[model samples]
Target: MTTPAPLRFRRNDWLELGLAALAEQGPAGLTIEALCRRAGKTKGSFYAHFPAIEAYLSALAGHWRETFTLRLMQEADRGEAPRDRLLALDRMALALDGRIEQGMRRLAQLDAGVAATCAAVDRERIAYLEKLHGESRCFAPAEARALARIEYAAFIGFQQLDLGLSPQELHDCYGTFMRLVYPPSFRSGPRV
Candidate 1:
């Protein structure tokens, strides 16, 4: 008989799977059996990875935060201009809207642990943005702080709108908002 290919999996496999499911279906759909089935792993594997369902969900939130930070920083690194850099950060937030709307935010609403993890992620993003703003000669320290808060809030509001715009459209809308909020020096080039 032909031997089956060896199954290779890591301890965190289910946690990753759980996050994806949560992103797709929300916390209500993240039952243990659902995750195992979605992951193509056994219940034993889930048990081996997490002591309980709550433990797995907590791990999933941490995973989401790490992933969000990495993506934002990567985008921020790509722009040569500070204004462009901030716009890039806004793009990252737009990219996250679908995942956030699908389930993660709702999950946080019901679970304090999940909410704290999500808040931690938001705090980290804001702190990073604040540092970027402070470093830019384009704006005074107070202005930078205020701009960061405005940009952050605007991005969140756009995401909540579920307007279903393409990424380019989202960026353009944000760019327009930035122009109205910041001095001319801080306006990025046309956001096409």
Candidate 2:
């Protein structure tokens, strides 16, 4: 048999591989050699995409923000009603890989750049949630802000707990949370 051709990786490829590595092995898995080995690529391929490990880490943060937060928000915005938007957002958010989120949180504890990125993403999520809750007319502005934080806390906490929950289990757990916190009038939807 002929020898296999060399692997060629693009920037996004490297970022995706790095994210997977982070999820699988935590921050320790992010070393240049580890990433290269996981991707079956060479140092040259990685260096061509990123000048250094710091740059790679920074890009990985950006990738996470784009893929997990901003994009989900955009998709959720498609729903006309605020309640529908909130449900859509919840569905997508719950379906995300919690391991990656836990990995990102761990990385944030180690890297200031990643910490700042995580902070920004948290703010963005809370702000969107606050807006949705307020617009749903289910709560007053002050209540909406407080509820948003509570909901966000639940999301982060679930990731940390790692209860071996499937997406459906996680969704059901959030539904239970919503049923407990939201008024009965707002609990008629399939989400609850």
For model 1 the TM-score comes to: 0.82
List per-prediction Cα lDDT, in the order shown: 0.72, 0.88
lDDT of 2 by residue, 25-63 (tens): 899989999888877778998999899999999999999
Writing each residue's lDDT as its tens digit, candidate 1 over 34-145 gives: 8766767678877887899889779888877776676678768788876677767776766764664447778989889989987887777777777788877767888877
Model 1 residue runs over 4 Å out of place are 1-6, 78-81, 188-192
lDDT of 2: 0.88
Q: Return the clash pairs for model 1, or none.
A: none
How many residue pairs clash per model? Answer: 0, 0
The prediction achieving the highest lDDT against the true structure is: 2
After superposition on all C-alphas, the RMSD of every candidate to the true structure, in Å, is 4.3, 3.1
